[model samples]
Target: MSSLTKNLDAIRQNNKIGHFRYTIGVTLFGMQLINYFDRVNLSTAGPSMMSYFHMSSTEFGIVSSAFTWTYMIMQIPSGLILDKIGVKWVSRVSSALWAIPTFLTAFVSGLGPLILLRVLLGVVEAPNTPAGSKAAGYWFPLRERGLATALYDSGTKFANVIGVPVCAFLVLHYGWQSAFFFTAIMSVIFSLWYWIIYRNPRESSHLSKAELEYIEQGGAQEDAQPEPGVNLWFVLRQRKMWGLMLGNFAYNYATFMFLTWLPSFFVKTLNLDIQQSGFMTAIPWLFGFIAEIIVGGWFVDHLIKRGLDASKVRKTTIVIGLSMGIALVGAAYSPSVWIAVIWFTIALTGVCVSAAGFWAIPSIIAPTGLVGVVSSTMNVSGMIAAIITPIITGAAVDATGSFATAFILIGVVLVLGVFGILVLMGPIEQMHPERNDSNATISR
Candidate 1:
């Protein structure tokens, strides 16, 4: 009998291999938690850090934006490298690269070194999101990808929820430096864990033959091998490429607003102390975390399985999520501080509800061997906004002494994002010359 046949029989007979896939997905999720923990820790430390360096608000914003400068530029190259080297090496090396800078962040003596280290942090961490997205695409089949993607993407929200409170405690006691030291330790630990546990389905010795066969038939790219002389120009030519990139800018504008400034917002606008602000920031992000994993990922998969067209289902869900993001503006207009947070909670939920679907799009539609490129291209928007928003918001706030203009600008961006996805993103399918449908056909 063929090895495939024999493996199928073993899978049918063995219970141990039945859910190895979940284990892998969860491990990826852990990596995200670690990745985002590093990002959020700085925010929890911001009030203290700003004072230590005698930094102006705009200068702090510049410091925040510094990380994304190289990070944004590196996305295309990072994606290509992940595709070439495979997720394993790229992920491990990138984590270590970022971890070193993260550890050194504890020692930054001035704004110059701080910004330099942040830039290094950005370059190394740039590969992470695309790599994680690739992990979802490669490991999970179409039916399960929504939740699978959610599982990993939710790590960012979870980091805010958990990382905020924990970092606040450390900042309150051991000092802000300890928070950096702690997250750095976790990154090193995750690198070792990821190396041992994660492997493509075909490369995994522990995965059942039955599970591998199931994944292949259901659209998981069991063979992620690139074709010789693969044409990336073709990927760049598709309208979906532009749509995804533009849409991401909108999604991330609001995300970075919260990630970089929410703690400061609580302190400055709401009159909360550092500890109160850190804990409060956790509340809205918790709503986001729950929505991403439960509402966005799991519910999307459920809808797709219930006979929805994969194309229409994902798009419609993402649109609704984007529209709900407008609620973020309401927070600025609220009468009470807690009331503003309530509005933020609702707005974050709306945004995160699209998280799984957004991550799933490239994996769902991108040509095999090019998922990394496509995913990376789409993710460049987030980096660009990360670079722009902090600096812009900080400058705007410094000039006005209020966050109202920044909030209104964010609302406008989210609206444009809705347009990008609705009008530009085409049917959820692979891009190829043989396909009869053109981008115009999917514009509706």
Candidate 2:
């Protein structure tokens, strides 16, 4: 047999599962769920938070923007840190640290302190996504990474689906503070549990030889170890990297604006009561969760089966999803609340469809072992947009006394995002020239 066939056999032999890998994936997914719940609880509690603090629309915007601002700034450094120290300690520490501020938000009395707490929360939580991406990159093989990333990313939407209703209930019965406190405690508990349970795959004794072989044979070379030096300048100079980064930014500009402001829009503009608003706010995200799971897995598999190039399949999905997101602006202008909700749900479903495809690109295109850095870079751009869009939307609302202008602005950005994906991203296999044909087959 040829050397390539022999290598494939060895990899397959190693790709077997034991109990430990399953535990790690579960723990990581839980952490992601809590991470999202903490970020979004503020949205569910927006009305009460406004009432409790007597905050203006602009003040609330600033408060919400604090998390994204800090999270954005920390993204690259967090990725670098993960690369150097590995994910185990960093993930646990960041998770535990973020929970402190989440718990303390219950005690905040004024806008100033609440904003400060959010900033702290952002700082601590900055590492969560990068750490999870790094862990996935390290543990899973190419074929599995898309589903892994989707499962992890879906935690965000799932948390929104569940946490919105739960938080709304807590705020109505106990108080807004109770919502924060509950989520905070859950985060802390999970952080500790994760630390106790997780082990790096290299160090894991329970992994079956078959599983290890599968990953190795799947072109996931362990030799691509994290280097001590990473040149941000070099990373930035790559046009393809910039394409991914900017594409991510455009995608998030609309998403964060919707996530941060949608609840308030329902209450203030649509005249829904808080409970009704919360349920309505959750509809888009619930649909988005389902879309991500189905599209992220099924779409790629279908493209591969049809003999489409992996890069083209990925880019096509992104273009379709982003173009669909532009419809959200029309949702904003709808005369009826139900119509608006339907439009919003459809738009977000599009975003979710694209999201899984977009995330899979990095894993497929990135140089071996650079998935963490690349993923972090792309997410940092998205977080930066997340930081600014809320504040800008607030200013727009303040200026116009309506969310219509803000929604339109976000829609335009989403349209631009479509172009970014189509023009800038080029081909997904460019970064891994040696394994191009092999990856294409697996993708198929």
Candidate 3:
């Protein structure tokens, strides 16, 4: 039998001979889980810090946004670095560097130091999502891209589900500083693990020849470096890229709003204590984690495997998922805590489903040699929203004395995201950076 046929047979027979791509996916997922654990520590500790520092919600918002300001500025550069140096090296260095800020966060005695560390944290961790996207591009075939992307992107949801409660528990018992120390240890360990374990398909002795052939034949970008001249400036000028930016910006606005403010909302709006809020906050993200894995990852891939048009399937998934974000409005008006959790759960589940598809887009659409650049460009938009969301939500809550206005604003932005996806991102196809607006449709 042919190697591809034999590999397919091995997979069908449940022989674990050719599935190392998923190992890569799981590694990326672990990285993101740790990355977000670090990110969510501040949110879990926000109330205590606000009390200790004697800061208003507005000032606290600025502190929370400090991470994204540098994160957003570094996105393009992060992408360039990843593209220039390659994923394994850039990721290795970033993973080690991020631990420093996370560790120092425990020692900050004043707001200035806290903000400076947050900015540094942002600077170091900026390569994370783009690197995951690039790694997925290199490892998985076009057909399996959704699941691979979701595997990692879903880490954000899973982290929120568990990280909030864990951080809160640490904050409640061992003090807020304990949470930072815990995450810093996790980061250091993961940095070492990743450095030792990760290798591209070509370099990996553990990967089977059969699997390598399967991936390459199935459209994995094994070693497709960016063509000599496809720069970030070249990527920025595309209309499709703009659509991606706008859509991702809207998605991330809701994401950051939830990450930064959800616990505060539970305490301030629902009248729950920090411990109760931590557990309650986990419900929505728990549902999000499940939906991202089952719906975004598996179901989308299943549909494509059944011979559905890849573009229509992805577009429909994104639109329907983002449309469900309007449920945030329901949470805003909820009369009881459980009711609010239910609404938020629905909203988050939808957002998570769309994330799988969104993360897959850069790999699917970027011209030869520009996957890293395109992914980072898209992330820049999301980080911009991340910077803005906390500040806007915080100001709204302070001005209105409630979270209702902030929730409504997020719903409106979600709607605009749908429009950007439908109207601006015409077709999910690869573009030629050398040619003016030339798109080559790929057959699934």
Candidate 4:
């Protein structure tokens, strides 16, 4: 009878759901949603804003790329800040502060002021990706990390799906400035909500002891502190880090190009008006969002839980998904609007699906208590590409009077990324800071 009682207790304990973690995941989703909304609005407003300021495509691209200049510079520092400070406060302060620049964009009258606000926006928003990574590492087990990462990362796609149309409506009815105001309001509200609700698993009153055990036993990084003796140079010296950086740079280049120029592509290249461009832009992203959640997030996690080799699964997904970026070539030469949308949708869906695996890699691979540093380091490479993609794309469009060359450039970059992943990202596993043996080297 005692043995039977013990078995039942074990079963019950295993079944505890720990509902609050999902709440945190959902909150992370909200933050990303708000982040991208602010970003895409500037692009959605591009045609109107350009016309208002008498700016050319190259000039507008400069404004779009301005955000990344500061963003790239701050990525590592933001990660270190999160490592020293906790996610709750870092997130709270960043969210509240980002809204100020987003709001002030509505009042800027010239290109200089507009550019300055964008740079400020980047400064404040730099912590978001690293913070999401840190929080996911803290709140989820290994098997669930992909889905948890997707839960927040997919918000980028969802924002494009919903935010484009909403911003278009605002831009059409009131003015382009209204879009900024709306996103800023959402950002402020989310800041307050996040402050009131978020806590590390150990500190949360809501997490049951059984659920907490399940999390820690399943390999959640619950402690929100950095390990001693780990330095930035130590992380930078890893070959695996460079591979992750290259992969991320390829992914981010394509993403930043699309974010800053997709609407304009519809407007200038496809000859669609703002409303048509807005709705059309939403279609590919809507599909991307759905794929991100289902294939990237849920399906990947489901496979890992079923005893598949986790590293193999993630690497396969990353390679295949990034390879899909080649479809941009097809989109570039597409003969009709529908055909173009179909191509872009295919490319973005692949990108989103792969993102589920790639973003989760930081948590899986970081040395103990250094997920933030690793994540930020990886992000810095991506931001370098992000900083330049818009400007380059704009120059290509202006020089050739077509977007074909720009799309081809992105496709080539992605192919290089796939090679980097295959050659340098040797395995998906944690690193030990104390290991001095060459065998302990993961990618090398």
Candidate 5:
């Protein structure tokens, strides 16, 4: 009886330290990735869809922009709604809503219905990043927050890595409609799993008291639960906020080019077959996913654990990443397709490294009280890039008869973002509405 009691006690202790929060974090990561798979699958399938509808490059651009328009419109509202209602409901509902439209896209034959369904999908999925950020905050302590944020936030690119190819394969083998069903079925299944498994530390039956106290004591705000009084106007006034917005737009302009146009570029520019384009397209994003997870999240976490100042750590990642992304121009000039893929892979790796830093910053800078509101505002700029880049690139391609000019232009935009960060951006620190915001960083 004594031995059995000791064995039982040891088992309970092991369970407590298993850090189930990491499990929840990774689940959100997977969910956000699946969200983006549904998003960018259209890019991979654009040729088939456009040919089927007898649409030009310009009209396809409109269809691509369809999701982003409503997605942009809903960012602010969705973030606040997630803050109020909590992650569980926001995530599950958003999944169902978007998944339904994704499913319906399979049945739509006309351009009008396709555009409308895309719009609805965007609106419903707008809560994705915001909810993932808030959920990261709830589950992770400060020390773990950066990596956790990066892990979930990198889902977009990570989706491109795996999701694009898989989606492309489905589109080819089973048809474009199958790509839609592939994502929808995955969404429904994951949302159900998330709804059943996820809960806050305080509310969770799986989390132990000792672990809960550890998180709450380590910069996790217990009082940040659903409440009121987030001031968006104040968020808009901060100089750093504007810089983030501008920087987001600039860098994402470059990034969105890949999301919306890369596969098409491969097929049209390099004369690859659909199968070759699908897998080749994933190559750069694969490098991106590796860099983001290893360098942005894991390396930064290692540095902080070694006693480096967190603000410097975050800023260093951002600047270096942006600088490296200038290589995108080289991709255009590469003499061959393989060489171009190498350049793009390098450029995207840089983007991923910096993106991990970018998403983590809002959590650190936003008043703990207003993370959702402020994050929504900053993230809007990224969606604006989504709205702009595809249409502009499509026009540029048609006008120039090649992607050369568009590639150089995208690199210039990313360089402008680098300048924005160096010139207009400030240190990574928590903001205070009551005082001067200029000198926000602390040496620690």
Candidate 6:
């Protein structure tokens, strides 16, 4: 048998969790938790911060966008670094670096300092998604990746659910600054935990021979360390890479709109108080967490068993989800507060449903050694949307005096995203031209 076949056979027979994989997943998940806390703390603190600084809605939007600008610029380079140095130390150091700025945000007395702090936070946090993608690529096989990616990605949604209410309470009780202080402390605690536990799969004491073989057999280069010869031009030239990049940008445009504005939307448009708005904003994310896990694992598995191509399966789900999200613009027009909330919830559910598949696409299309760089490139587009969406939404609110125009705009953009997925995202396989041949061989 070939090396790949031998590895596949070994993996199929091995059912045990190697201590190393478990530790890595746990550490990565914790980092993801901190990542979300640091990012979303700003959203939770928006109301109080706006009042304290006497800032305009546009200014608040700029503060939120600052992180994305830095993050977008840094993603590709950060991915390259992760590929070179591996995930362990990069993740540990980046976690602490971002956490420090988060802690310092508690001391910001004005918009200037707040924006500066957010930019610094973005610089440090840029490596997170790339690192997580690298970890998933190295540790898991094809079949389990969706579930594994969801488990890691779920940390962000979990933070939305848990962090919002907690931060709201802190803002209400102590003040907005206290909320930052609390999240900073949590980041510090998790960073220490990550450093002590994480290890590369090859170096991990817990991984079994069978599991290692399985990963290698599944076309993963876990044992084949990243070499220096990989070039950016090669990755940038691929049609598949562009497809993922554009698709991610569209998805994030919609996702960040909700992340940054949902709480504020509740407060201003729905006439809800801070605590009530926070809780209400969190409900959709709670549903999102459930959907991401279920769709990433069970739903995808069902498609695979039905003999669908992985790319087709992912694209189909995302297209449907984005189409569903387009209704949010209509939701924006609702007269009743409860009706608006329901529409927003449905829209967000569509965004989250497509998320896991988005991350998985990079792994599917990336060259064996360039997974980190490719994933980061794809995520950079999303981060750019993060920067721009807030500014646009803020502008729309300021110009229109109501969030209705902004919601309509966001809905229209989501529809455009569905088009991008169907047209720009051509196929899901890594080697798109050869996918037909692979399928034919499989049939034999």
The lDDT values for all models are 0.84, 0.77, 0.87, 0.86, 0.80, 0.78
Top-lDDT candidate index: 3
In model 4, which runs have C-alpha deviations exceeding 4 angstroms?
1-15, 224-228, 434-444
Name the lDDT value of residue 156 in candidate 1.
Answer: 85
Q: Write the per-residue lDDT of candidate 2 for residues 114-141, one digit (tens) a residue.
A: 9999998889998888777767666666
* Predicted candidate 6 versus true structure: per-residue lDDT over 292-345, tens digit per residue: 879865688567645567778888888877777776786667788788878877
At residue 315, candidate 2 shows an lDDT of 82
Stretches of model 1 off by over 4 angstroms after superposition:
1-17, 225-230, 436-444
Model 2 residue 215 lDDT score: 58
Q: Model 5: clashing residue pairs?
A: none
lDDT (10s digit) by residue, model 5, range 1-444: 234334434554665655878888888888788888877789988999988999877788888888999888999998778666777777877776667899999999899999999999888888888777777777776777778877887778888888888888888899988889888888888777887888878899988787776666556644364223336766676777777777777767878888888999888888886668889889999889888888999899778766688878887788788778878788776788999899889888898898888887776777765677767887799889989888988888888878888888887888788766766667777667564444432222
Error at 47, model 2, angstroms = 1.1
Candidate 5: segments with Cα more than 4 A from true spot: 1-16, 223-230, 437-444
lDDT of 4 at 434: 66
lDDT, residue 426, model 4: 77
**Tens-digit lDDT track of model 3 for 57-119:** 999999999999998898898888888788999999999898899999999999999999999
Worst 10 residues of 6 by lDDT: 435-444
TM-score of model number 6: 0.92
* Clash pairs, model 4 backbone: none
TM-scores, one per candidate:
0.94, 0.91, 0.95, 0.95, 0.92, 0.92
TM-score of 5: 0.92
For model 1 the local lDDT of residue 377 reads 86
Question: Once superposed on the true structure, which residue ranges of model 6 sit more than 4 Å away at CA?
Answer: 1-23, 223-230, 431-444
Off by over 4 Å in 3: 1-17, 433-444
Better of 2 and 3 by TM-score: 3
Residue 27, candidate 2: how far off, in angstroms? Answer: 2.8
